[model samples]
Target: MALTIMIADDHPAVLYGLRRLLENAPRSRFVIADAVEGGQALLRSLRGRDCDLALVDWYMPPERGPSGRELLARLRTTFPQTTLVVMTASQQPAVLAASLAAGATGLYDKRECSSQLPRILYQAAQGRLCVSPSLEIVLERHYLTRYHWGQENHQALTPREREVMRLIAAGYTGRETAAQLKRSEKTISRQRRSALDKLGLNPDSVPTLAPG
Candidate 1:
């Protein structure tokens, strides 16, 4: 059976090109279910017919609808059965991470569409996760960074900074921490500021009542 795919892009020309690309694949079995207007329209269209896959653009307009990461999340939550492949040019790590979390089966970069889109769709049809090389590395780095933060905590902190944070986290006063580490109180104060910088904490957000 041919897989049913819907192209949900705002531009008609782009949709036409994508439809042609998939329809004309030499040894492929795919049929165009419909070309939706955008992200919101696709969600509405799903109420009537089921599609095997959807090629979605990241952005959509009109005040009532969601776009980008929000749209990806809604599609996954509302239509879990469809394999969604985000067709976009966005390379931001946060966007990539959010799309994956929202259950995107693949991410096809429009900048590299001509060369990579075919392989992307082919793999999606075969039920595998496919992504553009650049997006893949962005996602890999995103995951590794998060993993290090979650698992090792303070991976971004220097050894001295980590010691400072650890002592502070353990409820030690600046003076007591300095004593414990055999460092001067002034040195402890500077170490705290350095740790805050590495830990991405703002000094303004620090508790005024916190250890001296």
Candidate 2:
């Protein structure tokens, strides 16, 4: 039987690229069933269609779209038969760790191409786990170090505060951070100020210490 595959990503360019790649493959080997966002992907799958595997994006913008650990957890319960693979541009240790825990059978970076994807998909189709080559080191370190999820709470920053920290850490200017987070520049400024204050650093200072 040809392996049926589904891909979920927010970017039209990526969706097109993935479709093109898959189409170039030996048609006798694969079939594209559905392509949609995280939520819609789940809904489509639940409609009783059969799929061998699903490639899910690690992050989809806007709330209620599956991303992070929640998406993995949902797939585990909702589609136990379909193998789940997470694809992401991010190399963040936290993001990778959380995705695996959420029940991903395979994890691949978006940077990987069709040449590599086929083998991974073939492995997944055979009930084997497929972890990305690039992330193996990071995942290994995470396991050896005994990293814990939800430990961000130790810093005691609310979700909004964590957003601010990530933007700043990524070196987004205050204005850019505001636009990205959909808040007023003034509000973002205040949140950064408060975060810096709580961390006992000058608000004007660059980050130097780990989150408390």
Best candidate (score: TM-score): 1
Enumerate clash totals for all models, in the order shown: 0, 0
Model 2 agreement with the true structure over 88-197: per-residue lDDT tens digits: 87877668766766777677878755577777788877877676777766555443332332133327666887798887788777777777889887787777767655
Query: For model 2, what is the alpha-carbon lDDT of residue 45?
Result: 64
Candidate 1: regions farther than 4 A off: 145-212
Per-residue accuracy of model 1 over 109-183 as CA lDDT, tens digit each: 887847577688778767787889877766555443433221223576778877887787677887788888999
Residue 163 local lDDT, model 1: 86
Give each model a TM-score: 0.65, 0.63
> Local distance difference test, per candidate?
0.74, 0.70
- Among residues 3 or more apart in sequence or in different chains, the pairs in candidate 1 whose N, CA or C atoms overlap within 3 Å are none
- Which residue ranges in model 2 land beyond 4 Å of their true spot? 26-28, 145-212
